[model samples]
Target: MKDMVELSRRELIKIITILNLGTTLEWYDFIIASTAAAIVWPQVFFPSSNPASALLLSFTVFALGFVARPVGSILFGHFGDKLGRKTSLIWTLLTMALGSLGVGLTPSYIQIGILAPILLTIFRLLQGLGIGGEWGGAATMATEFVSNKRYRGFWVSWIQQGLQFGVILANIVFYALLGLMPRLEFFEFGWRIAFYVAFVIAVIAAIIRYKIAETPLFTKLSSEGQVLRVPFIEMMRRDWKRVLIMTGIFLQASAGFYIAISFSEAYIAKFLGFSDSFAVQTVILGAIATIFGTMLASFLSDLIGSRRKIMIISPVGVILFSIPFFLLLNSKDPVLVTLAVIGYYFIELFGWSVMPTFYAEWMPTQYRYTATAFAINLATPLSGGLAPIIMASILQTFRGNYLIAWPYLALVSIAYGIISAISVALARSDTAAKKIE
Candidate 1:
């Protein structure tokens, strides 16, 4: 083993900025689409005789994006591992940008008949494909850039911060639009502005990404002729168990986040009698809490020198608090709802904050991007993608019974948490801090 090249403070900041921007840009587009699905898309693209049916249809489209993620993950992860993270990242950002642009330019169902929903679905899938590749490369870049292995958690947490920031931006933009325009006007045209803004963010992130250099580890591997011809196949053959374990570990974060941020919006608006703006506001607050909480959790992981411990602890806390979170939401008191939102977001970060570095540490440099992306993306479709649809189906099945619906969602989260905790506990992987090869 040789010493990893140390980046200067300036260079490290530049790298973090580039990765953070790309992550934020990708997620902004993704989350904006999700927010619209909850509030705006039902009327614009998937209008129906029954409002519930329309909402469900819209959520189906929303879930389709997640379904496309694993495909994106495989496609991008292969290139990320075989080529260079920098190049793969730049392309992913552009793909997401184009998807957002398409969504923005797409006409409403009133104008285009069935073609409107179909175009929306296509654009959303493109966004998913772009995001699938974006996260793993960003995480790999962030983790591999930092010189001190011990602080990788704190450093890579910034990339996760971009996830929260993206949520915040999405909610804030939607909230502002809700306030600025009447409900009809907002639904008609204001929503497109958010997607348009997403395109600009992607373009800016891409330009910034082009200026940054590739991770030193990947560069070293490439220089030494260690790049695999087929990184995904190689990883599956050797690290299949670890991959499965990681998928389980990621389940809670995937399901928990979408449920918290997206499904909860629909629940609050439709069943609880809150305004869409109110739901977006709560999510904005939750995202902010996640940003702060994840930062703290990442720092603690580095301080305690154990990423797995936080991962285990975080899910247990989320499980215990799951009922309380919904209870608070059901209370219908704005203060309690906000508190519940923030609290759930805060507790979950104990696992998510450390996830990037934790996943990166488990894989060798030659294929880290593919393995991490594949694991996370696999969980996305199974958990994140299904989360909103499942919750919506539950509520619909019960004819919009709040009491049954809330508890049921909480129980589902508990199940996901248990699976995540048990998987991490049982898995055999290198969780210790180590220099990247």
Candidate 2:
């Protein structure tokens, strides 16, 4: 308890690198399913619906994971705080492994009837629960373990970029499998293989995570018995506004971003008539954009102390670019689609890359994981879980008219982003923030 040890740059990088790799693998599982749903689930689970409606149903089941995320945050954050950071993260990865293998092995609706979608939903919920807790634990570890100590935002931002890294990996592997398989074979078996592959990735993530010790900050807190009795309750009672700000940021960032990334492949393939390979490739490019844009935005946030500033700009870009984005996709030309996805990549960067820092910065040392987990998770059910279903519903009713759907999406993004900007402008810390008034 009396030790005053200093962490070296090498040691800090070592910890951050492992955490980032594990976080990327976690996202790899999530994106694999989203991409799989866009490819296979509509036929497997909801064969009775029209293609559009079936896709909608598929994403709805997919959203089940997002729905389960906050519950995971509450439960895991409690134990992570009360027990230890390392322990919570290790188990979260294992939970994801079970869910992934479950999805990979589940019988289709044709075989199991209604039980198929039900079991699929349960697996996705478990997946979401694991991810829900994983984000804050990983971010706190990255931010608090660093040696430079000045650019917590940048380092945390780098960890944030791991989501895109996972997306890129998922996209590449899925795209390659699709390329190798015939269309019929691909739809029948390729998708399931991707889900199964997560078992291996999860094992790798666990191995890396196990080698890394607990965050020094958490170690310090443990010795002092500083863990919260009830982190979510304390944050809700004490720093409710940050929760609101995070909710708003996620509402803006997640819904629109999901529409752009998660929904884009099927949207383009079905509505715009692109080939499967092109659609998958478009997602890959956008992921690449996200990988780079995330780090760039995080670097800027570190310099500016304006995490909200980055999020606020993304929606504005969406509103201004929505028409062009739609137009770019509609042409079905690869170059134009790439251009559209590139625009989306930057949009995701602007909104998402800053979120880790923004949410983490909103709370102080005492309740960082708790506040960050709760605040950031509001996006799951509202924004993350619902975006694909909402977008599918919008297109189903409007029949894929951007005139109707994009404006509505843009409006939602605008309201959320503006409010987020206001909150960021007002919030200097939990105690001094004017937006709480």
Candidate 3:
């Protein structure tokens, strides 16, 4: 138990990497749907007289996944707290895997009629449930495994980076598949295979997750008879502010991400009329930058001792760059298009790369799962789910111009960034770690 409190660097990296990988896999499954929807979902699952309405129908079903997230948090959070991080994670990954696979295998609207969309919505709900528990468990695993008080800023951020990795993997696979096949073929058959691939990722992620020992932090807590009887109630009574603050912080990150990925997918593939592979390649290049950007943000946070700074400044920088990036996107040359995608990727990672460190630090060891899950799950899916749809609607109804939508994303990023900065400062100044309680 004493040793559990002070983990070694080797053990810390091992646990952190596993935590990162699991979430990476989960996010890959999660993110692929958004990309698929932007390109394929409308044509396959939803039928409408107009392209705008069809896209809306697709995004509406996408949003359905978000609405069910809180329910997943409640159900899985209960099991994660009462059971253990290890056991709960295995279940969570498998759930997401199955759901993702179902989506990939689903018969299109042409064949299934209403059943296609109905089945699609059901699978997305399953994904929301799996992800609901994934972040809290992953965050707790990384933070709790650390030895030195200071290392939390560095390694905990790795968990967040895992998300970037998942996104990277998803983008690479999607575009690579698109590239290998013709656009006509991709829209026809290739998209379904992407969903099928999740089954493989899930099996591997589950095996890796199962091989790891239960986190020492949670095991010690449980062995000492300190496990909460009701983790959600404990979170509400003890540290609701952390939930609220982290939620705000997550809003910036999630919105930035969805704009870069979700909305951006539609922007590039649907709007720009780029080849499906080219669109995926654009996203993949950005993912390449994120791998570096996210780790760099985390590493810098360790040196600076302030994650709030990274969260606030990087997003604003992204907002400033939005115009230039959009202009490059318009150039339409593959080289310039790739650069624009990469640039946006860097902007989006700014918020995501740093938030895990800050968010994971917000809770005490006892209630980390509940607090982190509630903040992040709600923040992400709501923002991630809505941003693309709203952007689509605006483009359809008001702005005939696509790049004009940058202001909308930029404004949301700034608002969330301001709120996050204020909250972190308040938390840092408080002397009692238990102030939230």
Candidate 1 residue-wise lDDT, 1-437, digit = tens: 23345556677777797789888877888899888888888889887776667778999998898878899988999999999999999999999999999999999999989999999899989999999999988998888888465677888899988998899888899999999999888888889999999999789889988998777788889989999999999999999999999899999988888888888888788788988989889889888877778887888888887888878876798889999999998999999988988888778766888889899888888789999999999998888888788878878887778787778878888888898988889765546566666
Question: Number of clashes in model 3?
Answer: 0
The model with the greatest TM-score is 1
Model 1: residue 424 alpha-carbon error in angstroms: 1.3
TM, every model: 0.97, 0.92, 0.90
- State the lDDT of candidate 3 residue by residue for 1-437, as single tens digits: 44554656676667777777898888888889888877788888876667767777888888788877777777777777788878888888998988888888788889978998999999998888888888877877666666345545667777777777888788888877777888778877887777788878787988988877776667777888998899889989988876877776666567667777777677777777876667776777787788888778777776776666777665566556766776787777779878877887787676566566566566766777777777877776657777667767877774446666656645654565565556555555321121221
The segments of candidate 2 whose C-alpha lies over 4 angstroms from its true place after superposition are: 1-5, 399-437
lDDT of each: 0.86, 0.74, 0.74
- Ranked candidates, highest lDDT first: 1, 2, 3
Between 2 and 3, whose lDDT is larger? 2
Best by lDDT: 1
For 1-437, candidate 2 gives per-residue lDDT tens digits of: 32213766677777788888878888899988888788778887889547778888999999888878888888877777778777888888988988999998888887889998999999999898888888887876665565235666677776777787888888888889878988787766677887788888897788778887776667787778887787777878888876776676667677666666678888777777777678888878887877777777877766775666666677667667766777677677879988998786677457677677656655655677776776667676787677678778877787656556665645554554565456455554432111210
> Residue 140 CA error for candidate 3 (Å)?
0.9
What ranges in model 1 sit over 4 Å off?
1-6, 147-149
